[model samples]
Target: MDAQQVFALLCIGFVLAAFDKKKEHFPLPLLLLAAGILCSFVPFFSNIEVTRDLIFDWFLPALLFVAAYQFPYRDLKKDAGLISTLATIGLLLTFILLGISLYILLSPFLEVSLVACLLIAAMLTPTDPVSVVTILKQTGPQEAADIVEGESLLNDGTSIVLFTLMSTMYFESQQFSINSFLIDFLLVTFSGAAIGLIIAFLANKWMHLIKDNEYHIFLSLLLAYISFYIAESLQVSGILATVAAGLFLSRHFHVNGDKEVKERLDGFWGIIELLMICLVFLLIGIAGGQQPYISYLYYILAGFLLMIAARYIVLALIMYLIPFWRHRFHFQDYLILGWGGMKGTISLALLLGLNAGGKNSEVIFTLTFGIVFLSIFIQSLTMYPITRKLKAQEQKKKESS
Candidate 1:
């Protein structure tokens, strides 16, 4: 879609949000998606197009930055270990297991490369915890919200790294080496984070010099965009850079900036976030409706099922192996973590970047789209019920004691 069309859709998004004031009918994102789907039937929206650049260049950095920024520093510090483990080791496990299972499942029915399967798995690896975390925050069990948000923020970097590596392997005919992969991963991840840290450090110093605290928002906006641009230009993880910059700047502002300015900055970013989320989800529905994958119905269902199963298996494995995690996060928490992992715009952006997988490229795209659609549609809808159930269980236990 062109800029005008995008802006039009965004206007519709705002209208939809206003209509869903109580959220009694549906979550805001899902409601927007439904609206977009209905709009997709119109002849004007028939050829709705979304490029990787359209999303990554326009939407991703700001959304990532705001999510990271709004996340509480204290919560992040407390759950740092668990979040890191899930983002790294847990992500890798899910990728491997899902990739292998997908290869076996699809091999009999379709001609898809191993790297392509891995790429699909990689696309699904990073969770979008926004919807679920919002529900958890409104309900009880704040720790689950913290861990889910923190893990999602970090895993986007690692998932992008994996996606890039797999794309290279498939497109360039390069072989995977454990040593090289590890080295490259470390370099991209750390370098991106380092760039963010450096930029944030300078920005924090600059923030101090500014007499008008109101202007801090401008600096933050520049920091979010510039850090991501520089990191991507340097062939590092732009997602990580934005996340790091967002986290650092947010902590700095909260700890030292004027209360009024902090609130102003938050209000500013909140608007940006709302607009982005609305447009993105609406676009997701429009994009999904553009393609008729009726023939891939079984494959889509199987792929989504496998993805959820893989996530649960990985989380269960982690809890089983780590006594600390087992004690700290109970069964219900893990269930929430597993189901709450929703895939969204990032996955679609990565899917759009697929250019070299021949016919399998289209197949992978459809599968990723289907899985993401279901993940957001189903997982997001059920999040409140899950949290409510857990809250009741906790209350009942308290009353018994």
Candidate 2:
């Protein structure tokens, strides 16, 4: 399908999402995904593919920017230690535990290598950003929302870097060394943050210099892609760079700009955000058709199970380690966080970067895609109920007090 045709489909998907959003029972993303899968069967959309280059260069940075920009920096700052622990330390622990389990359980059944297992774990490590405002909590607990959203934002970068590290080891046969990995990890993360901060600072300054709001929007766009490209070129985490830039720019970006300019920029980004969400999930659904789902059923099931177990274990440890975790968080809070850790576009995008020569590429793709489907359908679908349950618990405790 051509660009125009793809745009048409995306528009339709957005309409569907809007309608689905009205229905409390229907999960918007899950509906979009289902619609895309059904559309994939149509003869008109058979050739449509979500290319990796397109994802990295354009859509990814934009999505990452908007997410970071929209996220409340104040809340993130308040939960900085908690968020940082979950995003970095907790993420690695999840990857390690999940990877080891997948290796032990699936190695005998599936011929995938240890590196492939590590890659899978990395893909599952970060909570998908698709689930920003849990539909279940119209006015959810701010603390829980803060931790969940902050972790999702920061962990995307960590997950991207870890995925890259493991992919290099698998594809290039790079010798795996913990010391070297630690250096690479630290360098990549810090460099990405530094690049993002520098770009955001410079770009925001230039934006203010411009008299036109149109130019301001244009510069914001430039900042996103430029940060990503520069950081990637330097062998750092471009994902983090884009996110950092977004967070920095939006944190300082005030609503008190020239009315027309503010409106125009908001309108532009609003459209971009809607279009990205629609197309990304639709593309996910479309991609699923090409896979051999039945063959990897076992892998999909096992991976999903292991992922849930891994998230639970890591969150529990983190909660235990932190002195005040119980002071603010309860069992339902942890449950929501664990289950809300849905996998989405980024996970699928990283699979495309996997070595084609790697063992069972088709199987990897299928399992990853299947797991994503489960995450959206199962986890996201249940988030609302969990939120309500937690809210009720909070009310009971307050009344008793």
Candidate 3:
């Protein structure tokens, strides 16, 4: 889109955000999306297309950094084991199962390869940190919120790595081996994280040189993009790098920096987060409205249901069957986390990046767009009620005791 179109969308997003803030009933992301769809009927909005570069290069770093910066380091340390397992092993399991399921169901009717199916799985694997984390912080248990958010912060890297690997194998005909893939994954993931930590440490120390807290915030904003850009240029996961920087900087600032500065930082990031969320959902809505995929409604529903099943199945295996996680959370906690794994702009961004070999491109796009919409629309609305019920049940149990 041109500068004028982009500015217009931001203006609209700001207005929608104001309306959502005042009304305080509907979810802001959903409202923004609906508004985008409505606005798309206008000729001016109909041709707006969100590119992959716009998301990965421009939008994602800020959104991911804000989330990581806000997350409590204490909570992360406490739930590190569960979060790691879910982000890595749980994601792998969901990807494998969902990919296999899609291949079985779709290959019969559509011109899709197994790798393409797996690519689709990779796109949908990363739980969106934006919507789920926001709602859970308000209504869900603190522990549940921590686990979900933490997993999201870590898994975006893994999911992107997976997508890149699968995309290479599909598009470039690159030979894949389990051993080499594992080695590459570890190297890329940890290297990005290490770089981010080092940058964050340096950034924190530099903060001491500046007396103004405002400069500190500006430096952090710079740090987010710098860490991300450097990592990406080095062929590693920029998402993880940005996230690591955010987390480390947050912890350092909270523990040693001025209290007023931390509050100011929080307030600054809060507005940034809101603006990004509004623009992303609004753009997705407007883009989706232009190409209504009603014909693929069945595939969309199937993919959405399969994604949910894959999530619960992984959670069940990890939370209920595994000895380590079994006692940590109640069944309701798992239910909330499982159901709250909503897909958002990231999945769509990945889909936009995919080539999908030509004929299967439409199928992949439809599935990605359709499922993400249903996930954001249905799961976002319902998660709060589910979380509220779980809290109520826990409260009742405590009262009886």
RMSD of 1: 1.9
> By lDDT, is 1 or 2 better?
1
Q: lDDT ranking from best to worst?
A: 3, 1, 2
Candidate 2 on 293-370: residue-level lDDT in tens? 788887888889999999999999999777798667777778777777778877878876676677667667777888
Candidate 3 C-alpha RMSD relative to the actual structure: 1.9
Candidate 2 lDDT for residue 18: 64
Q: How many residue pairs clash in all the candidates, one count each?
A: 0, 1, 0
**lDDT tens per residue, model 3, 121-213:** 999999988776555576667778888999989998788878888888877778878997798789789999998998888998899899998
Q: What would you estimate as the lDDT of candidate 2?
A: 0.79
Error of 3 at 36 (Å): 2.2
TM-scores, one per candidate: 0.95, 0.92, 0.95
Indicate the residue-level lDDT of 47 in model 1: 77
Q: Which candidate leads in lDDT?
A: 3
- lDDT scores of the candidates, listed in order: 0.82, 0.79, 0.84
